[model samples]
Target: MDEKRLCLAHDDSLRMLRLARRCDDLVLAPAPARVLRDADGSIDPAALVAALPNELFAPTAQNPVDLRFDDDASRSGCSLVRSCPGLLRLPDDAYLEVLTAEGDPLCVCGSTVAHVLVEAGPLAMTSAAVTLGRAVGAGRLSRDAALVRLTGFAMELCGRYARDPLAPLVGDVVHDIEPVSSVRELRAFLDEPTGLHGVELARMAASYANDGSGSTMETCWYGVFCLPPRLGGAHLTRPLQNVALDWPAEAAGLVSHERMRPDFHWPRYETACEHQGGDHTSEQALEEDSRRARDYELCHIHYLPLTKKDARDVNAVTALLAQLLSIIAPYETDAFARRARRMLNDEGVCAARRVLLAQLLPPRLRWCDGDA
Candidate 1:
């Protein structure tokens, strides 16, 4: 990263830190340099902790956000848990504890606010968290707890915002409860046209977007919720159109594109499915499946299949990388300030500097092992 760009990222992290503190939304963790062992009996632990920021090392609540629940949740089959495999891994005790926490219903798994809405019969008080708990705890505890937890959050969000037409839309899709035997099945479910159930749900989402009656959740719904599944799948034509009509020119620009106007070539989910050798899936296989899914998701956004050399492709890759880095970059703090200065003063910090700078570098078009 260029000096200017690095400084900019540094500044952004500092700003984010301040915002996090003010909003009480973030915790800082800092990684200090470690000592090195030389052939000569000289040991410098400090040498190991390079430019790792203090903000990142400090204990914080954000670490759990990095976890991706790709485990099989069949601990015991339950209606909600059976539908989403990602939730299967949570221990029974932990699963129940999270659901029962008292707060405005939110996905504690990550800081993301729920976007999907659902019907929670006649509740005078509607909170996203409460509604989510209700969904997860609806039946016997036997099921994929995580799916019930996450999808419940989605469904709850939909319910709380029932006044907003988009609520029904989110409710229909998220609460449909498909019994996904594997990640492949889940991927297929997401990629396929919304079944009659999904279509009806989408139609509701569109109706809400179209009528423009309850635009309160527009930002959350479009900017964050729809992003993961937006690029492909489902008949989004009408919803996109409705969004285009309702959103300001700036927000509309984010979701709308020329290709969006036309019918898109839908992929067959079978192609994306990984073939695990045996009936009993191993941890290694699950790990492999997770790797494939990550690649597939990133490829959907970053792949330059047809235009390897195109400037647009280059720009997209770079922008995506920069945005990702911004999301993960450690915020500035007393320790970071000291380290930043030291990195400038000492050549040793150059390695740390490079890692941070890579965020600003134009993302390469070729495949990378990970976002790092």
Candidate 2:
């Protein structure tokens, strides 16, 4: 892999994740020195580490934020793990973790320095895939949180966002280059990844992953509904995410719209799920939502509407799951409902999953405890 790159050592995951939210990749003010390159033109790790800044300016819980996420404890230093000889066994929460490397390693599976940059003015920080791979290999996060991030990263790799590796997490898509990666490509990436740790875990998480998420919460909720019961979910059949559908004549007339795009849809069951965020509270959006519900009634497609409030509540989600199972009639309706309750209640498998995801997820995308 001779691609020009700027890599982050997977350390202090919280700090890295914070920076990643601001700029998915960093565009370094490239400074060229002959020491950075070997005679063969490959990157010289020792030279690169000494040349780069260990830390740069960033937010302490998303800049200019409310009192909730930001605090004094979050003001800790953001260290950039550097590479040199004897680079092995870093703190597990090390920068862009490297569990192992190939025949040509950056270090002994524990240290990583940036690759030989193209020296094209500046260098970008790190790719979402690289962050995800490192996080998984580091083995610091809970499996649920790691898998959620893996899925989100895979989605970022797909569609318009693929073009701008440095695009902000919540920014508009980049239209310059067409998307060329998907969850499948992510799997392929992990298969022969540029030496890192936790290849197997990342691969396994990718196996359960799908793309086409509109937001972090959407991705998290999808995992909630689709992951097997063992993973603290109902294990329902996976559904298509954010797909456009040609509405029937009756449906269009009912909603006064010709096109219908459901956030989550199951073709076999003819059911759909929509996640309502802050934008949905507007007067116009409320009217549209009312019309949409009417349209669903006319079309006979079972619709499930979820909001941030519904997402975080165990009783609410359990009740919602029961209703969904009743329509599908897969298992005894009451059983699945009760199962959801057991899984999501305090100290339940899903409850723990939620707590961790809330902590690990990026800025403005957390399932904060008091927010709901």
lDDT of 2 by residue, 283-368 (tens): 99999999888777778788888876665554555567666766766534677566655654535655644543453233444444
Candidates' lDDT values, in order?
0.24, 0.48
Report the backbone clash tally of model 2.
Answer: 16
lDDT of 1 by residue, 137-247 (tens): 686321223222233223222321222112322222221121112222223333344232222222222222221111222212221112122211111121221111122
Report the number of backbone clashes for model 1.
Answer: 28
Q: Model 1, stretches more than 4 Å misplaced?
A: 1-66, 69-372
Q: What TM-score quantifies how close candidate 1 is to the native fold?
A: 0.16
**Deviation of model 2 at 199, angstroms:** 1.3
Backbone clashes in each candidate structure, one number apiece?
A: 28, 16
**Best lDDT among the predictions, by candidate number:** 2
Q: TM per model?
A: 0.16, 0.57
